[model samples]
Structures are given as structure tokens and as C-alpha cells.
Target: MTLQTQLVLRALLRNPAHEMYGRQLADETGLMPGTTHPILLRLEQAGWVTSRKEDIDPHAEGRPARRYYRLTATGAAQAGAALAKARRPRTTALRDLAGEGGTL
Candidate 1:
């Protein structure tokens, strides 16, 4: 995973039960929206995350409804394992892949 992807995963892992919106996550991760949104799209595509639009009327709220993201049960487990592995020392082959931001 890229460092940006890892940051997003780590943030989600910190509070897996709490659903956070895109901008919220971007702010928390110190990443720009251009970076964070695509990472979220990929994670959702991988079945590691799920999202839903906030169930409030945008007009009444005077803002767009936020799309909240959270990790699935399997995602939480997988993310923990991935993060652990990413923290460990790697062999030459794995190090090369890591440098390229390859997936776990």
C-alpha cells in the first residue's frame, strides 16, 4: 500500500466503529481531498470499506450530505494484519515492492 493508503487505513483502524466522511478523513489524515477520495474508492472496491450518505436533508442542514465510510468486519481484521506486516522488517524482494507501493 502507498503511504497515503496506509494513513487512511490507520485512521479508520483507530475507530473502526465510527463512520467518518471524506473531508473529515482527509483533514484527520493531513491528506488533500484529491488523494483521500481515490484511496477510499479503492478500499471500497476491495470490499475493505463501506459507505453511506448521511440521512439528512441537505437543504435543512445547509450543506451537502456527507458520505460516511467505515471498515467492514473482515476489513478491520485484514487492515490490522496488513499494518502489522508493513511495520516489520522486509526481505529484499518485499522491500522493492514496498518502495513501489505494492499491495499487501
Candidate 2:
């Protein structure tokens, strides 16, 4: 996956049970809203994530309902595995250079 895609996945994976609005996710992932929301839409289209309109009284709150996103179990596992793989130590010559000890 692209690093940005992985970032979105990891952010959502952090709290699979918690629903987060696009703006909230953008903040948490340190990604621009443009970047974050598109990733979310892709995930939603793939059935890896789901979104809902917040169940609050917009008039009472004086604002529109926020759309909240959460990961599906399938997504959590898939993303968690990708994160784990990304975190694994490298065993290549590159690792001896830029990736590890030497400054390439």
C-alpha cells in the first residue's frame, strides 16, 4: 500500500470501535482533509470501513450531523497485518545503509 494509504489504515486501526469524522481523522493522521477523506471513501467503497451520519439533533447543536467512520473487522485485521509487516526489520543491504546503521 502507499504510505498515505497505510497511514489512514493505521489511524483507523488505532481505535476500531471508535467512530471518527473525516476532520477528526485528518487531524489524527496528520493528513490534509483532501487526502484523508478520499482514502476514507475508498475504504468505504471496498467495504473495509463504514460511515454513518451522527445521531444528534442538528438544530439543537446548531450544526449539521457529522459523518463518522469506523473500520470493519476485516479491515482491522488486514490493516493490522500490513502495519506489522511495515514495522518488521529489514534484512537487505539497504538496511545496512539508509534503513539501518549507515547514513546513505
Candidate 3:
């Protein structure tokens, strides 16, 4: 997964029960709307996430209702696995040399 994808997935996973809008998700992930929206779309298409328009009256709120997103059961499991793997430490060249008592 790409960095953006990982960030978005983790953000959603953090609030598995709550639905978040695109802008809110972007804010939470420190990503601009341009990056966040596309990732949401792709995740929706892939069935990892789902979205729906909020049932609010625009006239009452004086603004358009927003779309909200949440992860599916399968998505949560997949994201959990991905995040676990991502967090694992990998041995790099520097680390390997250090292990062999070499200089940095």
C-alpha cells in the first residue's frame, strides 16, 4: 500500500464505529483534500469502505449535507493486518552493519 493509503486506512480504523466526512478525514490524516478524496473513492470502489449522504436538511443547516464514511468488517481486518505489518521493524543496511559491529 502507498503511504497515503496507509494513512487513510489507519485514520478510518481509528474510529471504526464513527462515520467521518472527506474533509474531516483529510484533517485527521494531515492530507490535503486532493489526496484524501481520491483515496476514499478507491477504497469505496474496492469494497474496503462505504459511504452515504448524511440525512440532514440543507435549509435548516444552511449548508449542504456531507457524505460520511466508515470501514467494513472485512476492511477493518485487512487494515489491522496491513498496519501490523507496516509497523514491524525491517533490517536495513545500516542496521545489518551495526549488528556486525561495523561503523555507521
Who wins the TM-score comparison?
Answer: 1
Q: Write the per-residue lDDT of candidate 1 for residues 1-104, one digit (tens) a residue.
A: 78999999999999999999999999999999999999999999999999999889989999999999999999999999999988886577776876776665
lDDT tens readout by residue for model 2, 1-104: 67888888888888899889999889988999999989999999988899998889999999899999999999888888878888776768566767656676
Q: List the residue pairs that clash in candidate 2.
A: none
Judge candidate 1 against the unseen true structure and give its global Cα lDDT, from 0 to 1.
0.93
In the range 1-104, model 3's lDDT, one tens digit per residue, is 88999999999998787899999999999999999999999999988899999999999999899989999988889888988988776768558868776766
Q: What is the lDDT of residue 44 in candidate 3?
A: 91
Using lDDT, rank the candidates from best to worst: 1, 3, 2
Instruction: Report how far residue 63 has shifted in candidate 1, in Å.
Output: 0.5
Which whole-number lDDT from 0 to 100 does residue 84 have in model 2? Answer: 88
Point out the worst 10-residue segment of candidate 3 by lDDT: 88-97
Model 1 misplaced regions, further than 4 Å? 93-104
Whole-model lDDT values for every prediction: 0.93, 0.87, 0.90
Relative to the true structure, candidate 2 reaches a TM of 0.77
Between candidates 2 and 3, the one scoring higher on lDDT is: 3
